[model samples]
Target: MPSAPIKAMIMAAGRGERMRPLTDNTPKPLLKVRGKPLIDWHAEALARGGFTDLVVNTAWLGEQIENHFGQQSQTPPSIAYSREGLDFGGALETAGGIARALPLLGDVFWLLAGDVFVPGFEFTQAAVDRFAAGGKLAHLWLVPNPAHNPKGDFGLGADGLALNLPKDSAEPRFTYSTIGLYRRELFEAMPFGNPQGLKAPLAPLLRAAMDNGRVSAQLYPGPWTDVGTPARLDELNQASTTY
Candidate 1:
């Protein structure tokens, strides 16, 4: 018999402060790019890759999201929601939201932000298999630093490990694509990730892991856009249909 499909989590709880008026009522994940809800692109891609069990953590007008995907076809991934806004009274940040959704996920799972536009990304089982075999706590996909973030978030070492470089370091760095495969130990082994609700950011945990060489990463030379601003959204819509 075939193995069970891998589980994936799409982080959709961000308030989209940058998008402002557009996100005033609708959540960032529901914003459209190429005439489709940003999160749908991710869901379709993941489903095509055999990741049919999906968990979405939502806040900031999250009810719309729940209603939007209500009774979606089985061809798309099945969604189990982590209603952060209702349960925590607000968004729980990244790490905290993941922790809240931990009960719905598996030992190893795929993670990505719902607002990013990477239409070309393929969430393949081969990639999951490779990550599972690597024994690393997390495997991240890094992209060339975008125009808005020239400084970048993390450095990629020659050994395929993520580097926690100093801010003043003059090394080449890349922005995290918000796409990754994570081992449960990365969150559970830490003090956080409890289902009881602990609000925290994810960068510190990743940085600490990078320091210990437990995080691996690779450069993704695909089309990607962090659709954070209205201008960026407009740009994507006006640009290529190829994306």
Candidate 2:
């Protein structure tokens, strides 16, 4: 088996503007789908999958996230937080948040969104091992386009590299599931803040890497949901009997 990056980071800073009312006080990731918090699924899976260190970035109501897993430090997969808006205010966005958390995240790590529900997806050792051997800057999971986002984000080349081809470019495009494994160097030497953190999105950096043939991808034909809107949340809950 190839070597794997054991540390992981979950993006929990999104304000969830579309999920307001429910997200007004509770962070989107904390909102219950069936009976469990969305982020909890990731936490349990990461721990069960044998990951030893986990970092979570937060902004709006970040303390709740900290409180929920306050004792994780005393356990396995030791948890760390990259709190935003306490000294700076607002979130650091995805890439910015990841950069700020690099000290905890280390050189290579798994990065996943907290709001996405991928119940069957496992934080498998084989996936991590393959990623470490690929020498790529990033690896992403691409899912079939959901209704809310039909145009999709990137295309998968025969070599497994993500391509930023135009929507009509003829290459099959798919939605970014917001789950990835990344190398730290991808965020370095950029016009961005360091320890203090700054506001920025992740897509531009990813596209740049793809241009250099540094990002690979895989098509995940499994259950997944973005949970962006309240109605979508209801649909999930109504469609499920288990949390």
Candidate 3:
């Protein structure tokens, strides 16, 4: 028998406060990047890797997102929505949203923020296989520190473990690419409060896991942009021809 399709979650629930007026009218993930919605790029990559079971958590004008994707059951890569706005009145941050959607996602799933732009990144079955063979709770893709985040987020050891370094530590740190393979246990053990509408950030959970040496990471030396502000979006559009 054929194996089950790998499950993945595309996080689209952010309010995009930095994006401002643009986000006031359009969801960040729906904003055009090279003439296509940002989330579509991730969906296409996951489809290529056979991660057809997808769950998208939405808030902040979520109806637009739902309308764009539609509620189709028989589609090749089936799409499901965890409407946090409708259920909870707002976004559930990152870890909370994932916990809310845990029923749909299985033991392991690919997790990525929908706002970042990484056009050439490929979601490969080989990556899923490698993560499955390991005992780590999460495998994150880290990128060189961007000018906006010079302090970076986490340190990566030569052994592939993610390090939760001290704030003043001079060790090299990298920005989380927000692309990763996750085991459900990372979220399951957390106290997410009431399930009806848990609100929490993902950093604390990731840092705790990192402290325990339960996370792994690798550097991604490729074109990537967080696309947080209007200026960044404009730059991407102006340079669209290069991509």
- Candidate achieving the largest TM-score: 1
Stretches off by above 4 angstroms in model 1 are 1-3, 71-75, 189-196
- What TM-score does each of the candidates earn? 0.94, 0.93, 0.93
Could you tally the backbone clashes for each prediction? 0, 1, 0
| Pairs in clash, predicted candidate 3 | none
Ranking by TM-score: 1, 3, 2
RMSD of each: 1.8, 2.2, 2.3
lDDT on C-alpha atoms for all candidate structures: 0.89, 0.85, 0.88
Candidate 2 or 1, higher TM-score: 1
lDDT of 2 by residue, 148-171 (tens): 988899999998899988888777
Top of the candidates by lDDT: 1
lDDT of 3 by residue, 1-243 (tens): 434668899999999999999999899999989888898888888887778778999999889988787754436467888889988999988988999988888888999999999988888878888888889899999999888999899999999999998767889999999999999889877554337676878899999999999999999999999999999999999983665
Model 3 TM-score, 2 decimals: 0.93
Per-residue lDDT of model 1, residues 14-126, tens digit only: 89999999999999999999888999999889987978789999889999998888856544558899999898788988988988888789989999999999998999988
Question: What value of lDDT does candidate 2 attain over all alpha carbons?
Answer: 0.85
